[model samples]
Target: MAPQGMTEAALTGFRQQLTGDALTSGDPGYDEARAVHNAMIDRRPAVIAQCETEADVARSIRFGRENDLEIAVRGGGHSVAGMSLSDGGIVVDLRRMHTVIINPESRAARVGGGATMSHLDRATQPYDLATTGGRASTTGVGGFTLGGGSGWLERKFGLACDNLLAVELVTADGSTVHASEDENQELFWALHGGGGNFGVATAITLKLHELPAMSMIMLLFRPDSGPEVLRAYRDFVESAPDEVGGGCIYLTGPPEEFVPEDLVGKLVCAVLITYAGTESEARMVAAPMLELAHAAEMIAELPYAELQCMLDDPAGMRNYWSAEYLDALPDKAVDAFCARSSTMIVPSGTQHVLFPLGGAAADGPAHYPLPWRGSPWVVHPFGTWESPADDERGKKWVRDVRADVQPWSNGAVYLNFIGQEGDERVVAGVGGDNYARLAAVKAQYDPDNVFRLNHNIKPA
Candidate 1:
């Protein structure tokens, strides 16, 4: 049956106008095209327009609006809340637009809106250049950067938005526009952390930095030692240099060769120290965590691109994640974080992670919409499981983690790290003042709020 408001003739005409495939119910590739990274979200959009170019993106948006279909944009399909897919709307899929062009001399990369961290990283790695990218390889550059991108290299380079040079976008009216330091300046500022509220980004230009080498130290300890280990990790990060960045995590130990047989499949407290320099420098900087007794260790110098892929989570798993930015990581907060690990579904992909933000990440432009930049620490409960039965258990664990550390919370959050939090949180993600300004920008570019699937910023 044709979707409501979508006639067979109209659907066929829409397909004829696109250079890419348009899949709908009962279509050959419809199911696979609609599947997002989060297994829990199984929405069936009336139409999934696989856009291959900027023109295609504009056409898709116009078609959705003209037909009164809710519009969702799909880049990497990694939105934990599945905002990229709509239950019965039109999805403007940008996966086919994944292209990366590097300017070696200028030290910049013009990345396609649909490109993933792996795509951008690999393209720039050969030139010994990189920018802050998402923690996972599969994360979409569009959503990540637009939502204040964070990652291992963030402290050294800056959040991904800090490196943004320009963005080519398709606005609500199906018109193409460019946002940069000079063009559409207000929209550009909003684009820093405003997310996909204004339009569909067809391409984004990011400033890159010279990254000659990258190294990391991974130390695994017994779960019982989490409190003590986290305390020390906290102190270490407080004084760690800009080149040093990583996280202390409590996770189900994977069965890797370096992982001890006893620790595998069990919850373990592990500290990862990522260094932008050599292994020697990394070891020297990470000496504090190295002193702690560890059951397993892996310290090596590797390509920057390879390091970016280390935390790649497998797709097709149920996911629910939330984060709390903290003004400080007091000992009490440390204990609360460790205590909550017990509730996490073990033998699953759930991770109780604590990342420090300082140096370049916090030092970036203060005028942008990002509110989490100044917070020194962030407690991220990234819960991933394989069963529907664990849905409540997983979600509760994430929310409980947020509640546990609410005392020290700065009330600011990174929108990309969370999923469908209320409007208040959306305001908190970007400061109240910034939200008002972003809404005005939304009013100018998307007054009707055509793009509302993300952590939405309503138009003024």
Candidate 2:
């Protein structure tokens, strides 16, 4: 079947010009093609173009514009707002284009736009080279890095965007463009954290660093010890070397063999200490937290790729997440953060997390739009559940946490960690000055705002 609004002849012509498959409403895998990471989003696009190459992406974009249909870009289908899918529109699905090429000599990797963190990490692990990536292994590298990527290694190596070496994109007019420090420098700056508002990234090249050994210390404690434990964790992180990174979190104890039977399915306070070194060094650095009483402990040195998948959330679950960056984590602020855990929906996959920033991330390029990089700490409330009945409650809990932390908020947000809040929040994520400059770039590359599904930067 042809697309809903497109004529049969036009649809056939577009399909013939592509080296990929195009699916319509009644196509064999139409339903599967439209599915994204967040189950809460249920949009049906008029056509789904599974692009296999950069040329396919250009053709799909041109086809969508010619047919007067909204165009959505899909990379791992992980946008929390379901921006990857659109109702009665055209979706450029890039999952088929996922490919990673590693260059050990230059310590760099060129990743396909649709590749996931797992794809990037697994490819680089063999070479003992790695870069910053999202906390989840299944997150799209394009969306995550462009939206100011943050991860367990951010403090040590800076954000994923900081590692960006170059990008190959398909513009609004279906023209190919490349951006790097020496070529298309303005577009290169915007791509750091400006997001998909600029264009469709076909591939991105990232700088990698040698990571010989990585270790982690995970300690689970009773909820009552949250205040003291969080305070200690904060102090330890403040004085620790940049090689140390992790977070203090409140989560439902899992059924893993390491967790005690009694704590399973119950709320617990946990502190995860990640060290970019061997197990012996990690143990010595995390000794402060080890001295405290804990119900369960897991300490070992593992491959970086292995650690990236340890907390992977299963797909198809309802997800709503928000974040607040803080200039400080004072005692009172820590108390407020822990107090909100009482309202969290227990026995679920939700996590109330506090991540420390301010190492290499703060020292990175200041010209980029990521204003949140300067923040010393961040509180991210990740709400994931399996039922629609708890949607309202789960969303409310996330909002309540944001409100509780407002007293210390730095007013900067990481766009990747949030859904569609509003336009003002978009301005706050990127500084007011940076937003204007990004708008200018948008006008030059996408004057009509063809790519507006993301944290939109309207043409000037």
Candidate 3:
């Protein structure tokens, strides 16, 4: 049912104002339009406004407000919590507005709000320039950056928000606003790891860096060797240069040629060492891991954009993910991290990942709301399965991983990596002081909390 204030005539008028198109219950593509990345989320928004221009976004917000409809913003439709959709409300779908404009001379890319990582990366790859983006190419650049984006390149270039130069947003009242270092400075600060609480980001400009080459060395071992491999990985990354990045993961080996038939469809400890340099240089840097006994190996130099899509988890899977920032990864923590992998739903897309964080990521701006940036390591249990029957088991395994690492946890987390845990986790993700400051910004821009679907910062 439509909201009390909304009527058929009002919706018809709203559709007429949109340059794109409005999708309602009876619309031909309503079901397809409401489908997000996670198959578990099945929300049915009363209306989905596919915005083509900044003007369309503003008009959608106004229509939602006028009709007292809860507003949900959709970018890449990758919010695991389904924050991009609202039941019987309004969704401002930005997928149609994907337009990436790259300026090679300035080393910058201006991306439309709804653009995915592929859109941004493909545009910049031609110029040999790139920015830190989400690990998945399908992730929305707006949500990823605003939530403190992390990726394979983060150790070298820093988090996505660190590369953010400017943003153009549509506020709750349907007014346009621009944020940058010298303009709307407060709002700009809030955008750094504050999530999408301020407004609907119509567009964002990111600072890019030149990259001539990229290489990776992936090695897989028996799961029993996980502890030793993880311990060695922790020590290796501690001294590795900013250009060196990747993670130690426990996963069901895929049916790739490099993976032995025996290891495929079974748990294996995999270590991937990525370098922003040649294959020879990567081999030299990853020598320690290479010496380990491994069942499979794949070493090659590839384009950064191509590498970004290598680990893309298939869509339409039941997804549940959580993360923890660790102050240290001692041998005991490594043991605990590996031990929990036994509970994981294997032969599936689930990943028990341990990412080393340092280099430029730690050295980025200190005043931003992202308190987890300085943590030396992050343990992410990304759970994805095909069956609803495994939901309880998948969720429990993720929670257990968090519990196992709590002793070394810094209490700060990355919001983009987790689902709706609770309000306290929100405070922990963005610092207590930072949350208070962000609430003030929220009060100014969205006093009514119209954009409350994300990691919400309540208005002051």
Candidate 4:
């Protein structure tokens, strides 16, 4: 049993059913098993069952149901809210099933649910094949794709959800089914951008593309020039072609080894660039950004995966994120963001981004269950802190950033970035119409809502 307490007999019975590692709260690995990527979270689940195969996932699901225990499925455990654990329940951890099968001839890869972006990238990079994945190297492909992954290649290709070819799911009844275009097409549709409400996906097949050589540019401008900088960014996004994908980080200077110590905690604006063309083209593409104002330039040509790691935050940092999809980045909105951004506290820990999402993401008439499509840009306010005492400060910063963008936003957010707000935010993630349809599908496949923990979609 867990810290809250369960009987030894019940725990032994559960262990008997598990072929993979079964860690209880009393075990030596207990504290580490309960720890998620976000240090802010600390929950004690009764069972931390790491599944080795699809059968293990199925058995765990049934076991949790039979025992009347709440279930939390964890992929990368990178969630800011730490929704992958309950007070005293079963946690079906998918970390042990890290496998990526790449078929270069077909330009597709079948990945285990536990595989991280780094795992998939390492497996596919040798062939120069890539897919729509998260920006961070360690983010879980499962949670990111399930919530409609948006990233550096989104405008060139599409949402990660759109690239899904098929998935192996363990339904509420413990039956395993393959979902794709022909077999269970309805289930396939729900999987794209539906969050993790439908079922537990043991494996996913994704379509990959030949990645062209890319050059990224990193520029930092003064805080006073934030408004002009953001305005220029908006113009660049509006006029730039699909080949260019990048965003700006509004934060203070970080005390990296290369940066001077005095500039470490000062408010600054950072603009990052990643393009789908050659270095020559990236230079021309980055010219306008240079003209914005006086600042520092740390841009260069690098491997696609290398560029992804350049922005990685320090490990063990507490953070919260909120997002809004914009139809257009208005001048006033740009000014508003710049105004508050200059005053951002905690300097190096705060992050603000404007994700480019158009060309490919909006070009398709794809039948994804999620309502969001055709959005011009996605804005995320990523708040982070190294100290535990800064918890409320970080939370308030995220909340305020979200509030500032409300006027220009369309309300629907990227579910992957959302925290444990409430059902209202869940309904807001997928619009009312889409939520209803998802609910109906959920009722048909999972009437009891065994998988209701994630941006939960209750049965209709």
Candidate 5:
């Protein structure tokens, strides 16, 4: 099954139309092709094929299946666990397939699976419309949606997967099909939260929302003040309307133009407040954050797209991440955040963020494919490091901190923020009966578990 002896001749007919690069085991570009975002993952994929079109994607899947080669699908290649590449397998590099088509009348955008947050935001901003996306601009739309996307707009609109209208997928058997409410509805449901177990998505059609340009009140304070800030954040998040959502980021202050020179590189808590309202209305809502601590750069009235990139630039950083839903921000949990902030963060945007999961979107039952919804917030530890020697230290810091807050949480992890955890972790992400139901659905669509490469849902 290892494709070691497979020759270039096997894929000759399919190779003619490829405008992108295809490197085999001994090809000069093989190592570089297999190298994903994380340097820690050094997989020697049998073939790394960067595709330029949907046809190219179909071809790659066909070649891999014919040769019994395992498959890894790479969009923006940001998987912390490096699931984007497989050892001695084939990686369908869709990064070159970036395209965006907006239907203003339908309020929808048909996005190439390879597109990033930047692509979606840039396209939708002109129409004063957007949808749920990751905090960073570099994360891929494909992986994010497949894992149940959540963002600042989530509390307003809904989960990224919830807004998904349709998906064009090339399954394990190398057949292309469309997934939507009208057709293949079951498969569509699974892809919303099923990870990559069923197929490789070539394109996604997402529903957009009318959005208002708003304000950003970024507050920073000493680590000692983190507890009070979290409490303030809790009160605001619990009461704020769907028009608002801002996360609490506890981090080591960066030596940036905005941060005070004295506090640069020092441990601090950053409360990033974002709301879809005018300066006056936004300020009234942001009063909670101001009460928590001293304001750093509390500016308002910006373009929606600019405000979308308020967090650090997502590229070039080693992100070892995980997330969980919290029932409430208990005083003890707040203290735990403060304690972790005192020393754990690495310099340059290293932090822990508590993203608000409240809004009209969160007010739902198990109606959609996604599960965990009762929790009002999600706690995430985004561990960043500079050197390989420090990777374990950073991972352990996040792991320990996450464990410390576990008892106070709802025992469910948000799929989008999950990295390289086990099947048990994925099941926990769906919560209670949702996993069993998902398993039954998986049995129907992907019975052989040919798509076991992702946060897998084994067939019942």
Candidate 6:
């Protein structure tokens, strides 16, 4: 059914104004159109406008407002909290707008709002150029970059937003605006970590760097070795070069060729070291962990794009994850982090992860709202399972991890790593003062809070 305030004639007129197809309830692809990355979210938007152009985005926003309907924007639909979909509202679906234009000379790429990491990576891989992107290829560049993107290469190239050159956005009033260092300066600053509380981004231009080669080291150890392995990993990463980037995770061993049959389907601790250069350089830098006893290992140089897909979590799984940035990873803390691994759901896709953040990430602009950047390490309890029966257990394990590490927390977090934690967490996500400033910018661009589905910032 159409929203209470919307009539069939109005819906038809709205659909006519779009160059893209609109999917409503009972539409051929409505079910698929409304589905997001998390299977836990099941919402039915009144109209799913698969926008093909910026004009379509503007029209969809206007139609939603005119009909007193909530407006949600869908890009890769990767929000763990399912913020991209609205129940019985209008959805500005930009999947059809996935286009990437690369400029080798300028060393940049103009990515459509709906473009995924795969779209951006594949386009720039041929040129041997790249930028910081989400770990998953299916993640939307716009949402990831705007929410302060963190990925495997963050230590090398910094977060995705750090590479942002400009953004083309359609405001709540159905008008276009361009933000960059030289244009709409305040709004541009907010885009660094403020998320989509301002407007719908049509296109984003990102600065790219030359990436000649990439390599990785994957070593699996017994779950009991987590504390010792993490301690060694911590000591090595403290002085590791900027070219080094990766994470340590405790996950259910996958049935991979490299994984021993005894370890498969069992709780195992793995350490991954991704190097931005050649295999030799990666091996020399990772020599410390190489000497440790291990059950299995894989070391090779691969394409940067290929490395990004290696750890891709399959979609349509139940996911509940949270993170805590730490001032330091002391041995006691490592013990606590490792101990929580026992509580995690086994034989599922869940992972207890630890990512070291420093290098280029810590060296990036300190003025941005990403206060967590300065932290030396971050503990992420990434819970992804296949069964609803495990939902309560999965969510509790994530919360427990956060609680376990509270003693070392820097009191700041990356909003992109969490769901709607709370109003207080939102304040901490973006620094207290930064939140005030972001709200002022929010007031200028979206005073009515038209884009409140995300970690919302009320207009000042």
Candidate 2, residue 170: the lDDT equals 98
TM-score of 6: 0.99
User: Candidate 4: where is the Cα deviation over 4 Å?
Assistant: 1-7, 256-262
Tens-digit lDDT track of model 4 for 108-203? 999999998988988887888888788888889998998888888888888888889999988888898899988998778778778788888889
What C-alpha lDDT values do all the predictions have?
0.93, 0.93, 0.92, 0.81, 0.78, 0.93
**Candidate 2 clashes between residue pairs 3 or more apart in a chain or in different chains:** none
Residue pairs clashing in model 6 are none
**Model 1 Cα lDDT, one tens digit per residue, 235-310:** 9999999999899999999999999999999999999999999999988888888999989999999998898888
When 5 and 6 are scored with TM-score, the better candidate is 6
How do the residues 69-138 of candidate 2 rate in per-residue lDDT, one tens digit apiece?
9999999788889999989999999998889999999999999999999999999999999999888899
Worst 10 residues of 6 by lDDT: 1-10
Model 1 compared with the native: what TM-score? 0.99
CA error at residue 378 for candidate 1, angstroms: 0.2
Q: What's the count of clashing pairs in each model shown?
A: 0, 0, 0, 0, 0, 0
Error of 1 at 396 (Å): 1.1
TM-score of each predicted structure versus truth: 0.99, 0.99, 0.99, 0.95, 0.93, 0.99
Model 4 TM-score?
Answer: 0.95
Candidate 4 lDDT (Cα, whole model)? 0.81
Minimum summed lDDT over a 10-residue window in model 3 is located at 1-10
What lDDT does model 6 reach?
A: 0.93
Candidate 5: regions farther than 4 A off: 1-3, 11-14, 17-19, 25-32, 291-295
Give one digit per residue, the lDDT tens place, for model 5 in 293-388: 483665678876777666644445566888777887778888876687655755755678777776755774366556666577777888876667
Poorest 10 consecutive residues of model 1 by lDDT?
Answer: 1-10
Question: Model 6, 1-460: lDDT tens per residue?
Answer: 4556678888888878889988888889899889898899999888889999999999999988998889999899888999999998889999989999999999999999999999999999999999999988999999999999999889999999999999999999999999999999999999999999989999999999999999999999999999999999999999899999988999999999999999999999999999999999999999999999989999999988898888888878999888999999989899999999999998988989999999999999999999899999999999999999999999999999999999999989999999989999999999998989999999999999999999999999
Extract clashing residue pairs from model 4: none
RMSD of each: 0.9, 0.8, 1.1, 1.8, 2.3, 0.8
